[model samples]
Target: MAIPKRFEESFADITALATRFGENEAAYLSSKYQEAEVRQDFLDKFWLALGWDIYHQEHPNPYEREVKIEKSVMVGDRGKRADYAFYTAPNFLQARFMAEAKKPSRQLENQYDCFQAMRYGWNSNTPLAVLTDFEQFIVLDSRYKPTVERSLSGILEKFHYTEFGDEEAFRKLYYLFSRESVGNNSLEKYVEGLKKAKGKKTAKAAPAVQIQPVGDTFLSELDVHRENLARAFKRSNNELDGEELTEITQRTLDRLVFIRFLEDKLVEPSDIIDRLGKKSGSPWRDFANEIPRLNQVYNGIIFKPHAILDSPNFAPNNKTFDEVLAWLSHKNSAYDFNSIPIHILGSIYERFLGKTIIVSDKRAKVEEKPEVRKAGGVYYTPEYIVRYIVENTIGKLVEGKTPDEIAKMRFADIACGSGSFLLGIFDYLIKYHVDWYSGGARTLLSARLRSSA
Candidate 1:
């Protein structure tokens, strides 16, 4: 493949600038200015050379800027900012890449630099993060975790401007980055190829049995939708208080998740979101009208039998609904109801149930329940933990017994918050009975199980 003459020229100029700056100004940079100021100065020129309109001047249109410097995101109490975030389009909301810059004198290969960039990229759900100073550039795949043990050696690439003219090296950098490639997701494919080349070693290292939860990613995106939903509801109904806003958001999440799960399962009325997406007016009303039908289909998960769907439309307006739906429908959703383990939902909900969403001054947010905090924070018992207790207590009594032999098994939980343990026990009983009957001389265990059920 031929390198474009224009990009070649830009690279030449950038390499020349980098060489001169390294020789002349690298040593004095640390003494003259702080990290923030150096980052701004380098990014203003470096990003522009890479075909990014960092200042939004090339495209004067508000939504047409190739790059945006949005306000810092608050991870918790402290606010952290990405030095340069690049978007696939002029729309800033479609951010696809991130760049974190360090002072020219600071080592870009340190764990701190790599970890910080990785966190910001993962938080934004971007494919790649660039950690660079004027002298060196390191590209990190943000999908994977970075560890201090590896330093920056695990990154996708690390190179200096001294080799900018090497065709193979330049091609490697350009193919994986170059604005056009990153925007088209070719970069992601390239990174995935690298991971795949390692074969089963990598797969074995990160197996399904590892028990890593997607809860953080799910909760983060859920929180975003929750905030957006609350704001939209408040705008539509000013009389809503913080508590009301929280309740409505919680119900909305429940309804949406239930509908999405059923849709994925190909249950009846499987296209609720699809149908709702096609409509023009407020979607919540349509959903409300269908509540009775949904309740019948889903066994009353979304709506209870005599419950009233709040008037004035409990649904978000069109724009908000579209945005929220788009977020939920992203290609890499945290949890896929179809393939995810059933108990994983209960595990996630266990943590969720330990908290409540409250609006502080009309801004709905999640807060840990006071009792949960006093009891040493939200802790979800692992499925194995629940299984152990159930097997010992419930398992022994039911041994050597047929479904008909055992008329009924009684169990109780004094402190049942989310009923995850209870569900585990119920599942145990059912499985034990099914296995016992099937392994026995009975050829028609299906009928026996159905009768017991």
Candidate 2:
């Protein structure tokens, strides 16, 4: 049935509810309406303005009939009629939520009483409870769905009943209640779960690939193959010239080996010895020597075959070998300083490691592709990135120095590639420095400090 607009017993009525009583009853209610609860007054006015059919079971008559509220399923049984309940619109004459008004002076620490009143409407999806002392109103819900709010816009969600009438206060309350407003807020877990689900779904929508864990069997064979190749790669041409080569490490075998070289790459022998503090038979002996008996240790491991980009025709670039070595071992692991170019090291990693499979996206990308930038030659450092690093690491150190003086500090790069940013800083300083012993020395000094920093 089509319900009438709010407060209508039927559509033909457009009259004050207070008019239904006799002269004496009307007079008493009229007086009571003026001086009764200010909270009731404000709440009544506010909800009435929102087009609600407002009423009070405890009216002036003191003998009005009691009305029962619909109970919520989740609430099970703790449900009762509230002092007030406002229906959303006439069509939904069913109450959207209920409110229990307390005197402005009533001490109300336990919010469960207020929620119990609203739980009466749980049969319908939107079961809500609100308590007001006029000065403050608290809203509670069994409606698992959370509400969002922002300061710029009061209550980003539709419900702003409690926060209305005072826009500024409402705005602050809006942000105070966000599910993710605080770093350690309890609601953060729920929000994070949703985010992780979305991320997984997005990844699934992109592409996919197979990934079988490469075990020790695979790793051993690969390591043996790598050290064998490294031995050849490192030696002079004359050492390999006269010897009848076996090509025992075939392309197919190398490909299989390359795939796992990264996983089993040995750590520095020196570190193991350092930690053990010098031992005779401790697994440290194999690595503690001049050559670090890596070849024999890995050669003993046999690889069980599996497939993906595995075939006979693989000859790895020299750089890839070093990158894998660098990754498996630390930067300083190789005691020699003048070994090989950093770019070549990165290139080796790009070569043998193989492409990463975007399992969710259903695609595989070659390791040498996009994410890996060769040459280490950056075009420029973006201002925000530079400023952030400067602020955190160097800005405090160089705070008062003139730009000219700051430009000449010494630095070193752990993995410097053509030093583009260093070059950029040099260019910037040349424009500002008024006095310099020589431009080259100033530029070199500027580049040096940046590297170490």
Candidate 3:
């Protein structure tokens, strides 16, 4: 097949850029070249040639743009902005893939660079992402959860700047990432093909590696933390019964998780937990001291002082508290709470709430609560099911209602479990109200009033 005229032009431009870089490699690779310069001069043209509306020229509305620049996403406890996020038109809110750009001086193959890109993709539920510095372009498979230990894994393709001119290489790039191809669902199909091919190849050699979902993995870790905290508390306060121990342990874990979630959402400073983890004094005490202030600011039940748990006598050693903090830290943790949906957290909490700590002979062990066990264990309503139910019921009820009318209606779920149903309803109502406002509801109201007058 012949290369399209647009691609031919892009290839020529890229070749020229490569030649210029080659002539003064040191100068281009130096700090003076700058990331913004490379982005403007090379990357912009590279994507524009792929038929992307890089500047949203065709789509003038900010909300409807196919591409977003410097899109901020939560990664661990802080916000990490992706250099570019590409979307299929009309579904502009959900990104199809992310592209992270760095200066020519930076190596794209490093663990840090690769992991950063992968985390953004994984957290956002994006299947693939690109990491490049114009020096090297890498396509990464981001279906697997990212971890520091597996930072280098999941690299699908790598291309040097010189490869941009090669017909075969350029063709591959076009098929994989071009706006037309992506819009036609070619990228997803290609990823599926690769997975099937890999599965066949690995079938005879070894067992398939089971990739755990982020929510499940986090829930498992939460269980371990709960066990550790429960045992530590039991050892410290033998007078406390199993119920008291469980309440204290669960409350402490809940507060920590809540604060971490806030930090990732940019509502709290990133260092709030990290500073406590690194404190010379008791980390538990320092963390406890921060809760009162947090409660004052947020006025929430999570941070509110618990009569038993918040008492000075209700103390766990610094070591146990520090370990939990270390596990939740950005450097050590795999979770980006901001990207993980609230429903997933609710699901985790639902499961966590079903289990209780039992103390026997000074050892604490986690067991399913009797009610949960009788009910055959905790079950979370899938988000899809919840959404479907909400759409049919709450969605229909608020179809043309104003925000004030919708706000007056109350939603109830007697067996709420994790309150997933309520959350789905809340999400639907919020979107309905926002759409009503954004779609000139006020203009309609003004017209109606004028007609009456």
- Report clashes for each candidate as comma-separated counts: 1, 23, 0
Sorting all predicted structures by lDDT, with the top scorer first, yields 3, 1, 2
Q: Rate the local accuracy (lDDT) of all candidates.
A: 0.62, 0.34, 0.78
Off by over 4 Å in 3: 1-28, 40-68, 71-79, 86-95, 179-188, 204-209, 277-280, 440-453
lDDT tens readout by residue for model 3, 1-453: 122246667667667777776778788789878788888877877787787888777765565678888743454544456788888865554578888888898766888778878887776667888998788899987777786667787798999988877878888988888888888897789878986997888867763345566678788988998999888888887887889888889889988888888877777756577888356477887887888999999888888889888888778866887889998876645677766657778889899999999998678999999999999999998777777788898877766567888678888999888888887777766666656667755666677679999
In model 2, the runs with Cα more than 4 Å from the true position are: 1-40, 53-80, 89-93, 121-125, 144-165, 170-453
Instruction: State which candidate has the highest TM-score.
Output: 3
142-172: candidate 1 lDDT, tens digit per residue: 6643344443654888878666656577667
lDDT of 2 by residue, 241-305 (tens): 21112222233234333322322122222332222213443222222231224434444333223
Worst 10 residues of 2 by lDDT: 147-156
Output the better candidate (1/2) by lDDT: 1
Sliding window of 10 residues with minimal summed lDDT for model 1: 206-215
Question: In model 2, what lDDT does residue 298 have?
Answer: 49
Candidate with top lDDT is 3
What's the true lDDT of residue 377 in model 2? 24
State, as a TM-score between 0 and 1, how close model 2 is to the true structure.
Answer: 0.22
